[model samples]
Target: MKRILSAALTLPLLAAVGACGAYGSSAQPSGPQPRAAAATASAGALPTAPGSVTIGSADFPESELLAHLYADAMKARGVRTEIHADIGERAVSMAALKEGSIGAIPEYTGDLLAYLSSASTARTPQDIYARLRQAAGAQGLTVTAYAPAQDADTVTVTRATADTYHLSSIGDLKTVAHRLAFGAPAPTRTLPYGLPGLKSAYGVTFRQFVPLAPTGTITQNALRNNTVDAADIFSTDPFIPRYKLVSLKDPKHIFAAQNIVPLFRRDVLTQPMADACDAVSAKLTTTALAELDSQVANGASPDAVATTWLTATGLAH
Candidate 1:
């Protein structure tokens, strides 16, 4: 559910890749780094010092909810924790982590991988997590176990549109695509899994391309009003069900796996701290995430939603 800001959209993918690579190469000033030294501690091991940690989240509600889940669970295990939500996007949040402003943040595996290494070829959850761990390590970060829940980029259309066009999958759009308009964030037009990949992978080409905001508002309105026949929506967006939209299946795996995971400053993670976060991942499921998103979309507080889920799952008493 991360949105690439319009300013970033101006850069070509290759240029952005180079910029990310350069940022990764810059050395961080030595100070009190996260406790990555305790990484060898076995899963479920207690942290040497349980009472000192800060949890960070991105600008979105789901990320905030995830942050709460981690923070609450760690607190349950006697880890001193603080939540810093709405801390901006990955770049800003990651900077905060490295500078010791935050100990950990909720992250999506595929996106993290792409940010760390744009040339990454990892696609499935396991492969993406493996590459993400290695890449994060190089940048002085530690990645915890990934949850089954994912919020991936999806090509979706109104149920009416799907029925009319007999579109059940991305491949089915090949024949009717030329007659339809497509909508998504501006950068999606060039991202490897966006417009270019759609045509190359499925031989589907739209009559027109519309650039819309990633908030789901613009794209949803465009699709609902018939201004655009289809749009790129997040897989976990509650509006999809509210509007009865059909998310076309991507048998060709056009988008990379984006399982939710914890990315933290290596120096801050202790064996017990890692285990506490991993326990959350072990119980989190796609259905649960969708329901939580729906509740938040319906006006529930992110912290409330997260707490309810954690309690229900026995992660919090």
Candidate 2:
């Protein structure tokens, strides 16, 4: 049987576990965090263990759904699994993993690598994963095969705004940006990959900066009402299609790659378990992820959404 443990119930249990060491200083990069490759064998494939497994997720819908996917699939393969959903940010969740409160969690490649090594210059998926494996290994964790699905921080505008400015990519925005008001999370106004990187990488300088919620109706409404010309939105946000918004391409890789992958503790991962998780990765795509997210946003439970996908892909019975 699978169980979804509440934070209140789980935090006390995890309090006795020692820290995995600080991920980094609190002055970490302020990038969008709530956010793969073809199916391949896991890097450190080991045999299935007879013991139970504990899975966890960060405090986000998509991540919670993924935790269910992993737990249900593992259970199908005869591993007893339970989920600790909404465990807070990556740092908090990672601490739980290190202390044995949980064994696995879904994670993004580039951001995880960045958290591990702030100085990492990895841009491509392969480069980022390689660096991530090394960094994660140091923390007693392992990154399994990555899914083809990817999500990134994107500069988005209404279709009308794109048409009016003849914008097809971030670079094109440079020409008309000076006349437009840009909106995004308040921290993005100064983050290295936010306004600063936008200016340096694409020569984009908006007429004014409009602070708005990162991914919600507030930002969408702002764009729809023309209060801001463009906003920083996640690629996986379903609102992009529903509102007919256009996401400007980032050829310069300003936001970096964020392919989905499972990050788990080394002791609990076996070859069979690794392969089972990889099967899920093989079937997930960016389009599929967005659609699933749409369902969750519309009030569907993450567990139900995940079970449907797993059954459809023949990963669960």
Candidate 3:
């Protein structure tokens, strides 16, 4: 999926048939607390148990970064950590969490809520987090502190049309949508993040809707070349700036906040490891994440990009 992001024409289709995790509510655990402040390392790193903590990530770059940070932080706490990245789709990832095949992974609050309850009401980030905490606790997962970075749903328009019509928000596109072409993943037309919600929320009926690849090299090029006037992009996509395009703000906030957050098994996150994970969350911001995504989209490896950002942010030394 990461490789598919680079080419517009070859973007893979998202499996939108069902929401994530079909497990029973009885599987959920009980009791969780807010993350604690980062404590100073007393002396040598904490002691590792006999077993290892498994960290998993979905196929996205940001998820991979969060997984790397979690693994590295656990290592700093004297825990043996293993990262299982690119672990298929979200449903599979959630099932792994339930079965305890992996200890931790990155997740979004809004997406979590929708997956858990299948609700359509767009809650604020705070509400979403609290709701997910209770829901995930029952599932035996703990959602640690949420990071400042948000890679939520976004829509973008070519610079040509944006500048020509003074368009800035999704609302602005309604006036000129008939003259525009929409390009995005085919799933976008059906998913809440795509055309269905787009039309319902913004009343944007475009001149055409074309299936393109993910929001990386391919969809970006289509937008840049005016082959598609608009595309479904992520808020953290690097090409938003590179292509000189404008992201139409969802003022109505139809899309929920998809902030980066660590989801770990309760047993894996000892006090020291929890604190380290919290520190990484505290320092990450949307702007910084976008820059990192740019580096990867520009051809740098995700591992290299994650390592560089971790070192620079003092999350790793």
The predicted structure with the larger TM-score, 1 or 3, is 1
Model 3 weakest 10-residue run by lDDT: 18-27
| Residues 1-317 of candidate 1: C-alpha lDDT, one tens digit per residue | 24464123211110111000001111111232122233323223444777578899887677888899988998888888999988887889878988999999988777889989989897766677667777887788777777766677678889899999898788899999999999887888898888898899999999999987666666678889999998877666666666787778776667776777888777777666777788897777655676687787677888899889899999898
For candidate 1, give the lDDT of residue 89: 78
lDDT of 2: 0.70
Answer with 1 or 3, whichever has the higher lDDT: 1
Candidate 3 C-alpha lDDT tens digits along 240-274 = 65656666666665566666778776656666666
Task: Rate residue 155 of model 3 by lDDT.
Answer: 67
Steric clash pairs (candidate 2): 36-147, 36-148, 36-149, 37-147, 46-270, 46-271, 47-271
**Which run of 10 residues does model 1 get worst, by summed lDDT?**
14-23
Candidates, ranked, TM-score? 2, 1, 3
Q: Which is better, 2 or 3, measured by lDDT?
A: 2
Q: Give the CA lDDT, 0 to 100, for residue 58 in model 1.
A: 81
- What TM-score, computed on C-alpha atoms, does each candidate reach? 0.82, 0.83, 0.78
